[model samples]
Target chain A: MLGEINLEKVGISCFFLSYLVAFAFEVTRLIKKSRTSRALMLLFAVAGLCAHTIFLLVRSRAADLPPLVGSQLDWMLVLAWLMVLFFLVYSLLDESSALGIFFLPLVLLIVGSTYFVGQEPRAVMEGQHSLKMAHAALLVFGISGVVIGFVIGLMYLVQHRRLKRKHGQAGGLSMPSLAKLARWNRLSVMLSFPLLTAGMLTGVGLGLYSQRTPEPVQLLDPVILSYGVVWLVMAVLFGWLLRAKPTAGKQVAWLTIWGSGFLLLTMIGLQVLNMDSWHS
Target chain B: MNLQVVYCTHHGTDLTLREKLAFSDEQTARAYDHLRNEFPDSEFVVLSTCNRVELYTAQESAKNVPTHQQLAEFFAEFHKVPREELFDDLLERTGPDAVRHLFSVAAGIDSMVVGEPQIVAQVREAYATARDHRASGPLANAMFERALKVGKRIRTETGLSEGRISIASVAVGDFGKSIFDRFDDKRVLVIGAGEMAEETLRYLHAEGVRDVVVTNRSIERAKMLAGQWGGTTAPFDQLDELLGQADIIVSTTGASRPIVSCERFQEVRRQGDPKEVFILDLGAPRDFDPAIGEVDDNVFLYCIDDLEATCDQNRKVRKKEIAAAQRIIDEETDEFMQAVYHRATGPIIRNLREKWNEISQLELERLFGKLPDLNQEDRDHLEQCFNRMVNKLLHPPLEVLREEAREGTPHGLMDALKRLFHLRD
Candidate 1:
């Protein structure tokens, strides 16, 4: 059925087309101020979001699992989904137009890479218990939080720089103030730390539980080692935030962005290389 | 009828010229009386603001309205300024352009802080005062009332007033209010009596801040500023004590080093309620260290750059409203021109109606006298029929005259109608 429909191609292309329409609509707001233009922009965004959701749902159905607990394609889709969800929620909260201007390109970059990258399904334990699913769910949620933290941190630094430079807010692009962005960055770190810990704990339980199987899980694959290293760095940032006397918000923003960004890259690279520890 | 405006506004003239040209209330009333004496046949309304000085005049003849040079002379004589000083600065617009200009100014489209609401009120006050002094007639009255409507339309239809577009306004309006609940309850400490500080203090006072303390390096200057604003002068040495007590600290001193360092402010914050304090450091060489902004969650310190950055963003948002405002101006220009043309043709219309009605009434009476055998009901129906015939006969020419008025005043057509119909002016 999936082969006959080419669901992946249709769904992805439809969402991209919607984004194209949305971008054009948003640009028109530069020339004229109208509530109609704003409404139309939001309309196109929701359309794109709906198409993106459908594509992921179809892919997950083909793989016979929830999208987050499926293949590498599903993992990247979850991240994109999280990012878009954040954009929609935040844009609605404040009539701020800056989020789409900054984050849409990143979304496009992630979505674009899905074309060239591997979409093959990972091998599940022959008789998979629900614990493995729980483990994947926890990890997916945790990674999504880290991605959010990274983006918000990037925003915080940009806002901090603009404020420090005294370069007034530019047209059509308004970031949250330094004070608000700092608060968001701080909250993201504090929240992501606990979620990430739960994710690691769940993964460890899955690894120990799967060890009794005929093909026992290995603990020291590059994916696991890299995950450990990334998690450790994030822990250090978390600890510093808790102890440090109010540091400059920009410095904290940059550190969080780079540190979390590094972890994300390594994790995605390990997946793209198909370096799962279960096979090792 | 013809209308014209000779003016110099915030855009065309500097503040110095505007101040010199401005009319105080008494002066404005006297100017209106003088204008009546000088140009007895014309209608006049003088609009004066901190940013602009405009005189709008309307008359039955373009020859009667004051010229740019004459209006300049009027300003010179009225304000005791030299004509040579202001003649080059003043500009004039006549007819439709004049109408459009007044509409734009009244709507705040020509404002220094575009979309500000004060200009509309100023326009209303000008018109009212002109009426009070019997300075405006039908044409000027129609123009001003329509302009007020146009101002209301622009505000309701556009997002021009959605954001704070100035550093002084946004800092005090957005972030400052978010930090403090009320300004009247707080003690405002102004450091370095510079222009930015003065401007910020003015906005603060406008927001109901009364208990202000001025501290500067120069004692005399501080005292002078404090005296002007009804605030007490704090000695320069007491900056630390004042810093701790001030709920709001606005620093625009041209200091070479950090006037309020993190260490200095942190000690100050300890003595005060640790809830919240708003500090606006507007100096170029950095009066307060940026590190001080990081001292606490409650201490929200914004420098000139930060506040200005928000203001720049607001300007972009405002730029989007320009098209909307222009559309309003265009619509209003059409409406006003139509009304003015109709007014120009009004007397002829009335004379034509009266002449035709008299002929119809006389013919109906003659017909009734010839046929007394007809019933009273039939005579009444015949009277209605003749009145309808007169109206039907007049409709086509009236329509053509209206069409011609749109292009212009229909001057040739109007003269022809008056002669052909034996209409009296």
Candidate 2:
């Protein structure tokens, strides 16, 4: 019975259902933890990851392009894939950490948003393959870092509130120390800002270079315009962070949350509206 | 089945009495020798700590199990206390109860400060010392090995061992650690040289805070506190300057009013290295002004009431986990007891099976001789039938014996089996 189901037929629904179940199990642990529930949670998460990998590979094979350049749907899935990888790594390293609860909902939304986004492949201009690759890779990584920072910020706030209230650590809700969270949050923003800026610069070069080509990227399109706004917000936050004094951990956490959260929301909201994205 | 424990823990005994009863390393060797002489057939392990002094002993035979009175007399003799006075203080448990008590102690549920990890190391070291002295046997080794695992299991599974309970520990662990990453690079300024200051200093030293400065009105007391902690002493009048220079301040001074007001702290902050400061006001009268907690974003201040409340919450948290921990201990205790009972019944059961199988083999050889004319297949079939019949007949008695062993050593059933089969030891 198990062997009858073919791996080649794996689809988004396959992994999507697995992740949905895995998320449910994770919630069960928070409500009432047991060894069995934790085991099931890990099992479903691993199964979902395997299915997700297979689906991505199969879809890339069908499209004759890498998932990053396949479409907006593929782009969102790739983002979710990176985050799921991070979530699994974090959850595996620390069994008691509450990363799954905060991380999974975001991953689910990112993956779920793929259904609403366009599947038309993005453009890869002549003689600019490497630049497009670099742009795609850098932005994917930078966005991943932003998502990680946002998650860590949320955790910092939760732990900070619990500490401020003088509450003992609740079972199955283990969080990192505020100092460690703050340090990671700082590094994520610091590292991702440079990558994002480089990605945006490469994108601009591609757009300017495309002016002489047959199909030029829509530089002032709604997608690009909204992305620019998000980038501006991040730039402001990064500048302030660099110039600011050693502020309290709570303030830093809030800033990271709002800054990263805004960038993600604008990108997703624009893609969901089916605006004329630059690559389309 | 022969295991026993006689102990006086902080739960029931006075601190003075426990201090007198606690065995030092030098005394433990001598005590082991004395116990060996008194009970040559028994395995012994002596666990001596500030909060508890337990004597875990087991014997190979139930008949050799030492009496409670004899063990009480031993403690009285060893401690040089009068027998009658020490007898009532020392409580005793035998068999399953004794195993449960050890598991509880190992898991930290029985600790005065529930969830303190020091007891696990203390128990491990005690067992190792007993092994070194050739005092521990297989039963004691099995119990202690399982006990260490039980401690780890309980710690991982339940929140019984989570969070810090003491005021000093909470101040350093809950708040101080949250603000600063490491302490070795930070300067520690301890005010007043009181007991609370000393305790907090000990925790800080453990966290690698080496640069310590103690100040007080009496230079002598300050010098003593500084000397004990390998730090320097500052004059009390230099409090403002010291406050500015130090990154972490623990003020336990018994002052009538707030020594470091918010205005004074802000003024001092200007001269200070503009870095984060952690102030733990462990003083009863609220030294360093509660208002200073909100004065600067970099300044994290916690007073006595704040730390005390956290400690109380920590205690309540530990109390809530006791039920969970007790469940684990109960389950492990039953499992351990069942294994012990099976170990006790092992030799008898093995001999019975071997003896009965020997009779079956001999009878089969005779029957084959009588049926020499039969075909090979027929003879083989008969032999299989006989073997099956022997196993089927023995199954019921063996099942009964195993069931009986789960509760305890099935001594009566084993004796009856030996007699009925005319078996030798």
Every model's TM-score:
0.72, 0.85
Model 1 scores a TM of 0.72
Task: Give the per-residue Cα lDDT of candidate 1 at B141.
Answer: 95
Report the C-alpha lDDT of model 1 over B299-414, residue by residue, as the tens digit: 66888777877887777777778888988898889888988888788888888999999999999889988998999899889999999999999999899998988877888999
Best by lDDT: 2
lDDT of 2 by residue, A129-153 (tens): 8888788888999999999999999
Give interface RMSD (Å), model 2.
Answer: 3.2
A264: Cα error in model 1, Å: 1.9
lDDT of 1 at B58: 94
Clashing residue pairs in candidate 2 (N, C-alpha, C atoms within 3 angstroms): none
What is the lDDT, from 0 to 100, of the residue B206 in candidate 1? 88
